[model samples]
Target chain A: MFSEWELKRYKRQMMLFGDDGQERLKKAHIFIAGAGGLGSPISIYLAVAGVGTITIVDMDVVDQTNLNRQILHFDRDVGKKKTASAEEKLQALNPDITVNAIDVKIDESNAVKLVGKADGIVDAMDNYPTRYLLNDVAIAKEIPLFHGGIRGFYGQATTIIPGITPCLKCIFPKAPPKEVFPVVGVTPGIIGTIQANEVIKYLTGCGELLTNRLFIWDGMQAHAEELCVERNPACEACRGITTKTPARTKK
Target chain B: MTVKIRFFARFRELLGTDIVTEVVPGTMFTSLITTTARKNPAGYAAIFDEKGAFHEFVILMKNGKRIELTDAAKTPVVDGDEIAVFPPVAGG
Candidate 1:
């Protein structure tokens, strides 16, 4: 059920994943949790890729200092709500897809409600408390959590399928002490793209997901590697969950 | 015996990676890292607390398996082992 314009808009990418795959993208809804550095690229890419609906939430106003890596905002957007700028840019990028940008801080009280019914949750957040909140919601909702983090020249990403892979709590167990972490735009650009790639693959049912492995990127060394990750049998957040059918296999 | 220690992210920045070092046969995981990380005071501080215990957030793995922070003190490193220590990169 694609319009003539929709078909033409998605022509090049459709070559890779025929009409059936295009339909999946057209029917999916992805929830991205930030509108800052990682969220900028993640939402833009997903929007253009024809994901039918994108729900991006952020509470901060764009500051002059954000222009370096938060590409969704511009000098003109300084002092504008990040959600407002994100919605405008994402909608402009793909008029065919729906973009719902919400202005609110994501906390345990609202995380689940905010994510309501989305096919997947993209962790574009900058801190661990909210990331852990999103992780709990992902486990509770039994959806996939596409996790990405960046600091300076280092970044890491992993795809967590609720019952099938190690949950975030299982992997880190403890949160790192908070600090004003240093970063460069390319760091989030790389990690965010990896996360967006994971989302596209998850939606369209192509390629092996980043399941059971942590992809670590060291931009300083121009190297990328993955370490095997396993589910902790005693993980407090997802311990009771059991693998039934792999999410990818469910596709 | 010989073992390879790989430090990642900030740890890697402070202490280089893929460090091949010699250790006594009975060396424990904690001591091996303590000795290697000692080469750089900042690196040691980043991974350990004032009391020299591993920071709770530091993840340690041997041959692709996770080693709990508490168990690292008693876990022995055998010949040809590959150890990885890193902090979760926390940013967007």
Candidate 2:
């Protein structure tokens, strides 16, 4: 039963997209990796937007450090699993939707199957190995992937539409040695919001996407730009690689 | 010849923008940046650190091929090339 108040509350967005947009929202399922900095905003935005279903995958436990930007949890929620805390917050925010909080880390073994289950995925995980796995599986399976990353005063995003756009591997074959680069949590919030925007735009079949174009934002100088990138015909993850789609993981 | 420019992750932040262009002769990839940076200080500062070498995490590419910063000065740019700069990417 759609309520008048709910309709009024969502009128602006509904007006922009119409009943068809609402239907797509009702049909969409989003898989978000990580419940850390980026995941917090991604979760909140998707849930509030009335996405029909969301599966949040993360294994970390909340700590004091995350409170600065992990808006899904609070001081009292510390020591709770991140996926659980985020799930609780998201469900509380939108009782109209389903939030599946999976408390687990994504790995090669489970990457393909887990990703295949969703309509699209938001790359919110904060490391390289998992990023590669996400890129590889997403490409092999021909799924849309929204990628966002933030550190210090900078952040970037790109939309990978499987074979249509470049995968993360074509751009970066290997990850640099991980480091605790200086970061302010809100940076992730900014980028994560854009990631959510891309997800929404992709789901609703809205305007032209960031496909093949990278959106970069810098907080220091308050400047942003979009650069064009093309697919590499020989990309190991896309064209010339012999790889198996990792089967869906044990539920 | 013309070369396309790209920025990713942190490099995009420090530079404050994404794409740039240059219509220079086949100069070294590094020189093309210096030429482009002449008009955009943020782009210059974004790529070359205090020592003028790309920061350790920075990755440079020529027409989609990865190029070591040490050789950026010698990597000749050809027509229709795309040069990319990215901070260490961290995401899944």
Candidate 3:
């Protein structure tokens, strides 16, 4: 049910995915956990790609210091809420899709509700506690979680397909000590793009996702590599949880 | 036994990775990494605590499998094993 405008808006990309793929993107709803740094590129790309609904949550107002890496906000948006800024820009980018920008801080209590019935959750958060929360919700819902994080010139991304791939806790059991992490825009630009690319691929059922591997990008040396990762049998987060479909026995 | 050690993110920046080093056949995972990481004091400090144990957040993997910190001391490295050590970046 694409509008005449949508077919035209997504003309070039539709060539890559065909009309069916375009329809998948038009029907998918994605929940992004932040509107800063990584969230900026992730949401922008998803919005333009015509993901039917986007729910982005952020509690911080744009500050001058954020202009460096948080591309969603500009100098003019310095004093405005990040949600307001994000909503305005995303809607302007694609008038066809719906954008819901929530201004509440994501904690254990409201995280599940805020996420609602989205097809997938994108972790653009800056802290592990909240990321853990999102991970729980993703596992509970059996939805994929596209995870990305950046620091200085380095970034990492992994796609967690709930029951199929290793959960975030299985990969990194402990959170690195929190700090005012150093970052440059391109770091998130690279990682966030990878995340958005993951979302598009997931929604369209395209190429193999980044399952069972951790994609590491080191901008300093301009190198990218993936370390093969396995699920821990005793993983506290996903232990004993198998995919819904039972394996068929060989004849 | 020859083993390859790969460090990621800040640890990689400080230590430089893909280190192929020969260790005694019975070398434990912790000691092997400790010996290599010691080449750079800051890198060693980043991965180890004051008591020389792996920092709580440092993740260790051997042949694509997780090696819990509690078991790192007991886990032994075999020939041709690829070990990865990294700290997860907590930024957006």
Q: Which candidate achieves the best DockQ against the true structure?
A: 1
What are the per-residue Cα lDDT tens digits for candidate 3 across A67-180?
999999999999999999999999999999999999999998898899998999999999998988899999898888999999999999999988788899988888888899
Alpha-carbon runs more than 4 Å astray in model 3: A245-251
The CA lDDT at A178 in model 3 is 85
Report how far off residue B92 is in candidate 3 (Å). Answer: 0.4
For candidate 1, list the clashing residue pairs, or say none: none
- 1 versus 2: better lDDT goes to: 1
Per-residue alpha-carbon lDDT of candidate 3 for residues B1-92, written as tens digits (9 for 90 to 100): 79999999999989999999989899999999999999999999999999999999998989888888999999999999999999998899
lDDT score for candidate 1 against the true structure: 0.95
DockQ of each: 0.93, 0.31, 0.84
Q: Highest TM-score among the candidates is held by which one? A: 1
Q: What is the Cα-based lDDT of residue A134 in candidate 2?
A: 82
Ranked candidates, highest lDDT first:
1, 3, 2
Tens-digit per-residue lDDT, B19-61, candidate 2 = 5565767688877766655565676775666667765556777
Q: Considering summed lDDT, which 10 consecutive residues are worst modelled in model 3 chain A?
A: A242-251
CAPRI verdict (incorrect, acceptable, medium, high) for model 1:
high
lDDT of 2 by residue, A1-251 (tens): 35676577567899889877777876788889889888999989999998889999998999998887788889999999987798889988988889999987799888777765688889997887888888877776666788987778777889887766778876555566676666787788888999999888887877778888778777886878766666767777888533343111110
